[model samples]
Target chain A: MELLEEKIRKEGQVKGEGILKVDSFLNHQLDVALFEEMGKAFAKRFAGEGVNKILTIESSGIAIATSTARYFDYCPVVFGKKYVSLNLDQEIYSSDVYSYTKQQAYKIMVSKKYLDKDDRILIIDDFLANGKAVEALIDMVNQAGATLVGVGIAIEKGFQDGGALLREQGIALESLAIVDAMSEEEGVIFRAQSEKK
Target chain B: MELLEEKIRKEGQVKGEGILKVDSFLNHQLDVALFEEMGKAFAKRFAGEGVNKILTIESSGIAIATSTARYFDYCPVVFGKKYVSLNLDQEIYSSDVYSYTKQQAYKIMVSKKYLDKDDRILIIDDFLANGKAVEALIDMVNQAGATLVGVGIAIEKGFQDGGALLREQGIALESLAIVDAMSEEEGVIFRAQSEKK
Candidate 1:
């Protein structure tokens, strides 16, 4: 976690309207080495929770989830695809997600064949801003009658309500770096979670 | 490669209309152990090419590219984002890709900050059907004056023109499993390759 926090401080850029630009390392351009570190952290946090599968919404979440799956006995990572492809299964569990970053609502889907009542799912994502995407993934897990082990995130906008809401629901959510506040001029302020709980 | 081919034969479903759905283990639901094998194979193929970076498009490609990046000396993996985001850099190298799967022509953008002339990029993708997305990513690499060491594809539709065209261009294209034909009745037929050539 310290390494991630340090990397964010060094490369992440704070922008207006609570936006953090991490394309240089995290978002558009990924650091695979850092992803492995994050994977180890998630494995430690979610250890012994019967996590048989890793679930994430597509685009950004796939890399982190896939990397993290290696630590969980190489569990299958089922991503919620945003677009309907011919390759996707017809029988699926779908949910709507409202994106605060994109300012648009889209559907996230996972094939029913992947998730079942016997599976334990760990929801992972790159950023948890409004928590809409995570909520949708959780909804899909519920619809599939699977166990919701917990959620793992790389960066959590602490100022946002998503992390708070998940924690309020008694979900064991772990974010490697929580940005308490970020400004272009003031830099980034990460929440001190050493005393969490 | 034998393991991958076996996975496709076992879990991969052949639907009507020229579609082979391997969502059970490849794209939608990913197997991290299998991905590691793929990473090792790609590393072996692109070895000594000085592949400094792994380039890929978003969604399905992100997970594989991230997995493959680990085997390449933990190289940085930069994925081309399909949609415009608020945090994206204003300066970008963009290309148009017409997705026959989605039936939409979307722009793929990579931040100009990540890629440079000195970088040796290896493009990785989940599938190489018509090669539109891979071609667009190659174009983006050219736009940035970066060197494309080769293209690593998980599955290539050998019946399609994408694989043929890239091979004809003298590109070092390596596909783990190339399906020549498949049908609901006739089953899957793979184009035999010279042992890991």
Candidate 2:
């Protein structure tokens, strides 16, 4: 977490309207070494929760989920594809996600073949803002009759409602770096993990 | 390679027309252990190429790219973003790719900050069919003035023109499993690497 916070302090750019750009290392351009560290941290936090699978959304979440999968005994990582392809199976568990950034609503789907009642699923993603995407993934898990183990996120926008809502629900959510506040003129302000709860 | 071939032969579903769905282990639901094997195979094939960076597209390609980066001494993995967001920087190298499966054309863009002329990049992807996506990625590399050390593909549809075209262009293209022919009735037939050229 220290390494991630340091990296964010060093490279993260704050745009107007509470946007933090970490494309240089986290999102668009990825640092797998850092991701491995994050993965280890997640593994340590959720050590014995019976996590048999890691679930994530398409695009940004795939890399982080894949990195985290190795620490969980190489459990299978099932990502919800955003785009509907001709080859996608007809039988799928899907939920709608509204992206605040893109200002659009899209469906995230996972093939029913991947998840079931016997599986214990851990949801992972790169960023957590409004928590819509994570909520959708949790819905998919619920629809499959699977147990929701926990949620792991690389960075959480604490100023947003998502993190607070999940905590209120008593979800075991671990965010490596939590940005409590940000602005183009003022830079990012992070919340101490101890102080967050 | 044997493990990958075995996986394809066992779990890969050949649909009608030219579709082979391996979502059980490859794309949608990922097996990191298998990906580690794939990363090792790719490292073995592209050894001594001085690959400092792994380039790929978002969604499916990010996992393989992240896995491959570790084998290359934790090289940075930069993935091209398909959907444009307000946060995306204006300065980027963009290319148009026509997806045969989706039946649509989309733009793939890489931030100009990540790639440079001195970087040695190895392009990694999940599948190579018509080669339009890879070709667009190659074009982005060319735009960056970076050196493409090689291209590593998990599966290549040999029946398609993509694999043949990359080979014809004298590109160092290594596909772990090349399906020469496939159908719902006939199943999948892979081309022996020795017989491919």
Candidate 3:
């Protein structure tokens, strides 16, 4: 987590409206080495969770989920597709998610064939802001009757209530770096270290 | 490649409209071990190409590209975003692509900061039907003045013209398994071994 925080401080850019951009290494252009390290940290945190599958929403989440899946006994990673594709199964557990970033409500789906009641799923994603995306994933898990073991994120907007709300719900959420505050004038600020109950 | 071919022959479903669904292991629900095998095969086929980066489109391509990047001297993996986010840089290389599967036209963009003229990029993707996705990626590479070393695909529809056109242009294209022809009735049939040029 220290390395991720350092990387963010070194390469992350703070834009208007408090968005921290780490595209140089985190999302657009990826550093596999850094992702592997993050994967190790995730494995360490959820070592005894009995996670059988890793679930993520498409685009940015796929790489991190795949990397983390390697450490979790090479668990199969199932990504929720934002758009309907010819290859996707028709029978699916679908949910609606409003993207504050995109300014639209889109559908996220997973084939009913992949997830089941017996599976322990770990949800992973790039950013946890308003938590709409993570909540959508959790909703899909619930519909499938699968148990959500935990949620893993690369960066969490601690200033927002998304992470806090999840922890209050007794959901195990582990974010590698949590940004409590950020501003063009004031710079970025991460939350103080505290173990989540 | 044998492992991949075997996986397809086993779990791959033959659906109507000439579609072969292997989402259980390839794209939607990803098998990390299988992706590792694919990465190794790609490294073998594209050996000596001086590939410094793995270039791919977002969502489906991210997982395979990230896995393949590890086999290429830990080169950085860059994914084109289907939708621009607030976190994206202003400067970008953009290309329009028509998706036959989704039946829509969309723009894919890569930050100008990630790719350079001197970089040798290897394009990785899950499937190649009409080759529109790979062509769009090649266009992005060209726009950035980067050299496209080759393309590595999990499955190529040999019946389609995409693979043929690329090879005709003297581009090195390697598909783990090329389906020469397939039918809902007769199932999937890969191209003859002699056709593997």
The prediction achieving the highest DockQ against the true structure is: 2
Deviation (Å) of A75 in candidate 2 = 0.2
- Quote each prediction's TM-score: 0.97, 0.98, 0.97
Window of ten residues with lowest summed lDDT in model 1 chain A: A188-197
DockQ for model 2?
Answer: 0.92
- Compose the digit string of candidate 1's lDDT tens values, residues B1-197: 78889999998888887788888888888888988899899999989999999999988888889999989988899999898887788799999999888788999999898889999999999899999999999999999999989999999988899988898898999999999899999889988777334
**lDDT, residue B75, model 2:** 93
lDDT of 3 by residue, A1-197 (tens): 89999999888989887678888888899998899899999999999989999999988898999999999999999999997887787899999999877788999999999999999999999999999999999999999999999999999998888998899999999999999889887777887667433
* lDDT values for all models: 0.90, 0.92, 0.90
Chain A TM-score for candidate 1 is 0.97
Please list all clashing residue pairs in model 3, or write none if there are none: none
lDDT score for residue B129 of model 3: 89
If you superpose only chain B onto the true chain B, what TM-score does each candidate give?
Answer: 0.97, 0.98, 0.97
Give lDDT: candidate 3, residue B193: 56
- Mind giving the per-residue lDDT tens digits that candidate 1 earns over A112-134? 98899999999999999889999
Which of the numbered candidates is closest to the native, going by highest lDDT? 2
- Model 2, C-alpha of A166: deviation from truth (Å): 0.7
The CAPRI-style docking tier of model 3 reads high
